[model samples]
Target: MADSEDSTTPPAVSWRAILRGTGALPPAKKTGGAPSDPALQLWRNWQANHTQVVALTRQWQRIETQLIHSVGFPQVTIRLSGEEEPKIAHSVDEIEELLADEPEAERETLIAAFDAQQKRWDEAAATLGFDAVDAELRAALDKESDFTASVPTTKAASLPGIAAKLSIVIQLGEPSPKDTEFPWPELRSALADLARLASPEAAISPL
Candidate 1:
């Protein structure tokens, strides 16, 4: 009788079957075609732009570090009115205030000096394919600006995840070398690895 009652009862619903029935399956596989959903496409575009931005940011960081380590700063001589030139104030705050007051005079001079140094640094970077990086970053920035204008300002949790992934990728691609701290070699190797991952042809391209 018990066996008969048990047999009469319907089989329990499988959790996996329930999930599949409820449309809870993993996302449909991408086939390299244009995304159908507008939101998804926007997210994808934002992801690509963010990747380039992060890469450029890392490259710029390396360049700035190298610059600071290699080039000695010019001794700033601030002529103070109080007495004895105020020991040639080197604090950024002091310089900022000084330049702020004399917009046409000291500000212009400071700007010109910065522009000259920036130009030289940019030129040096260009020689090392850094200019292309800047262009890529600019393009990414333009895309970001467009996306920002279009999207409603919402505190979406999605962006922070993508940003974090980008940060990790950049960090992994440019690991610090041991002993000798200079990472130019490591950075170049990492870039090559990234290029290879991006395209098989790049992996075998003649260096």
Candidate 2:
């Protein structure tokens, strides 16, 4: 009878009970409320979109200034001489005829002419400092190769008629005067138009 009572007794409580007693359950999380102002939200979005453009413009200006300081006026010159003259053995038709006839002698002459011409061109390129100029140009181009354009990311659906209106504003900014060969004045006018288009209200309520 004593053995049966011991067998009926329950096992010890689990460690999971200790966890529950220690308040191990995750704390309740708080959710944020929706943004209050639609206009402010649009402005914030526009600012974010234009941030990259602003950075790129600054970088471009810096690069331009650096180039101006590094190199003033750039020019390339080439020189040619008779002693190193390029060989000219045959016309295009003559080569074609030689090829058709399978003439070994003519082929050898053509090969020699090609080699001489290549040598002359090489000499000319060296005399003009072509390699150095090319290197400098390449380095300058690399320095100025930050080509980035900023674009707004708000879906078109969010701003139904805004893009078309903005385009019109951009066009109006470039008003041309009669008989002007260049469009500098028109471009200046375009800036004014853009300013008007990008009015505070339009920026806030782009829709």
Candidate 3:
């Protein structure tokens, strides 16, 4: 006969299954500068605003997560440009496959396209001394469906007289480079202002 202890034993829980369970997730703890101190509270507000500004730099949150994968960031489901509300890349190929139909010039064009949008975002926010999308590009949805806006000039003046229309697509094993410049001048200014305030906490903590 089998032992009663063996019969009553529960199956072991694999780490994978434990991770899969969201029901046991712990709640986020809300902790920041002291509630009694207005100066510390103001600094905390600046810090929170900084996070919002950074999110705009990505143009979309999912794309942001994909660009920098880490814990605390959820596993974002990347979908192609479709009727879906959110889209990171036009086609799956844009992310990895088509590898960016290019001549060195075409690659530069693509990078420049995104750079211009970044320029618009940065210069606008800097002038206002506040982060906002103003008359244009304020709505993330406006940007989400704009695949062409994200694409750079089809061809730069890499070759003297060849029109891009006449050019042939070149396939390379490597992926096209992205516009790597995401500036945070507004955030920097806020931090600088906080530094100038020279509060005791500000002096002790540099962010």
Q: Which structure among the candidates has the greatest lDDT?
A: 1
lDDT of each residue in 1-207, candidate 1, tens digit only? 112211211112211211112111112123455322333344445556666777788986776576556542333455646556443433445466765655467755655555565566656665667567667778877876776554443222332222222323333334442223455454434434433343344232211
Compared with the true structure, what per-residue lDDT tens digits does model 3 show for residues 50-168? 34444665544443343234222211223334446543433234434323533555545444554554555455445543344332235443433242232233332211101111111
What are the lDDT figures for the candidates, one per model? 0.44, 0.34, 0.30
Q: Model 2: per-residue lDDT, tens digit, 1-207?
A: 112221211111211111111111111121254223232233334333334344555555555455445442122111223335433333444444434555676566565655565465455555545455555555544432321111233222222123322332233233432224455445434433433343323222111
Clashing pairs in 3: 109-152
TM-score of each: 0.40, 0.27, 0.19
Pairs in clash, predicted candidate 1: none
For model 3, state the Cα shift of residue 199 in Å.
40
- Clash total of candidate 3: 1
Weakest 10 consecutive residues, lDDT, candidate 1?
17-26
- Give the clash count for model 1: 0
Please say which candidate is ahead in TM-score: 2 or 3.
Answer: 2
